[model samples]
Target: MLFNLSRPPTALRRSTSEFLQLCRQLPSARRALYVTSRSKTMSEPKVISVEGLSSSEANVSGSLRNAPRVHPPALMASVAILALLRSESNKFPPSTIIIEQYRPPVDRHVVGLISEGESPEQTAIRELEEETGFKASGVVQSSPLLVSDPGMTNANMKLVTVDVPFPENLEMPAQKLDPGEFIQVRIVELAKLRAELQAYERKGFVIDAKLDHLASGFELAEKLRQPKSST
Candidate 1:
């Protein structure tokens, strides 16, 4: 994240001059600005100088402003499927796809990147089948478009819930993962989801943020549905 500015870039030099001028307009503004920006994300502010700035700096200053918006690359976009297994006992438990892989140092949900020319729902269905070996009859619910780590990256995802009918033989299907993908599927009761995630964490396995949030929401809803004890 460090930027070398020995001979500062055109935009940077112009921005520095403009910022300094604005700071000098008010009493003690320069000191305040220096402390706020430097102490937070910057190691040193000495590289920023307003000593020699041309009048043309004003014209180019407008271009230095951050872009109004950015579109995430389609290749980086993904879909996460929440697959619920419907059993004969009328219990619809959700299956958590634990990714035991090399890259993420932790476990994740049933998620896959949207391939070229593929829709979000299609990606969801394919991901469920490939990661957990369960075919989604249909999408039960679709969440709003979500952006994970907005501060860091603009990558986006769609979360869809699907119902998977349990087989009569009660045997889980074999997973059809892509090359080098290692995943384990577990059907967990909704009530025990949070506890299961906590247990995984205790065993030195970190839970994905999105999955953790889902489990926490379930736990919160269960608590709120219970009657309060009398004081």
Candidate 2:
């Protein structure tokens, strides 16, 4: 389900400051207002009191104030694809692609968000193809919904890994990026994932904690894939 904020009511719009003050007096009322606004699309504007919002919500509100519109969901959910492309000829080791894109209220960064009504695997395939022009064959692993930023937004992200086959000398497909979406797909060796993440951090990009955790899990999986030696 998606929650959206529309324009404010006439009375609420008349005095934004007064509405906020009232919100501070009644937290339940504030939540109720949000519930109503999000339940259905509002043709007329719906006002919300920022005073009653949590710190994270307040921050988001502040960021959107200058913008002409704001539409935030009540419970945000996203999916990240850990795509692995391997050469069929074994000429090259398997590598994965991570995206660099611009995120709202923040500078350019590395992350991807799943679209609504799409399953994690479907999101994985769609995002992979759109962002990197590679189609995933199947999902190898999937993570439960993990909190992205508990303090700020109630958004959660699920991570999934899918296998991508790239035969030798095959031409890559063209990427289909969304409008205003500036994405750079960087392919890195599986073993050098940590170093690549660190490099991104050094460049002043806020690395998503979920990505770090997912990378750790991938590292463990790689280690486990190694054949056990006879004692």
Candidate No. with top TM-score: 1
Q: Which ten residues in a row have the lowest lDDT in candidate 2?
A: 1-10
Using lDDT as the measure, the top candidate is 2
Off by over 4 Å in 2: 1-76, 106-117, 169-171, 217-231
Would you estimate the TM-scores of all the predictions? 0.62, 0.57
Could you give candidate 2's per-residue lDDT for residues 1-231 as a string of tens digits?
011111232222323355435545654213223111114454643322122232356446433222111333333355667777788998678777766543333221123554577677787777777767878889999877677545444446666778888777334677886544444556777778777778867755656665676568778998899999999
Root-mean-square deviation (CA) per prediction: 17.8, 15.3
List of clashing residue pairs for candidate 1: none
C-alpha lDDT (0 to 100) for residue 115 of candidate 2: 56
Q: Model 1: what TM-score? A: 0.62
lDDT of each: 0.55, 0.56
Q: After superposition, how far is residue 148 of candidate 1 from its true place, in Å?
A: 1.1
The sequence of per-residue lDDT tens digits that candidate 1 reaches over residues 143-189 is 78787765334456777787777643245788887643444456666
Model 2 root mean square deviation, Cα atoms? 15.3
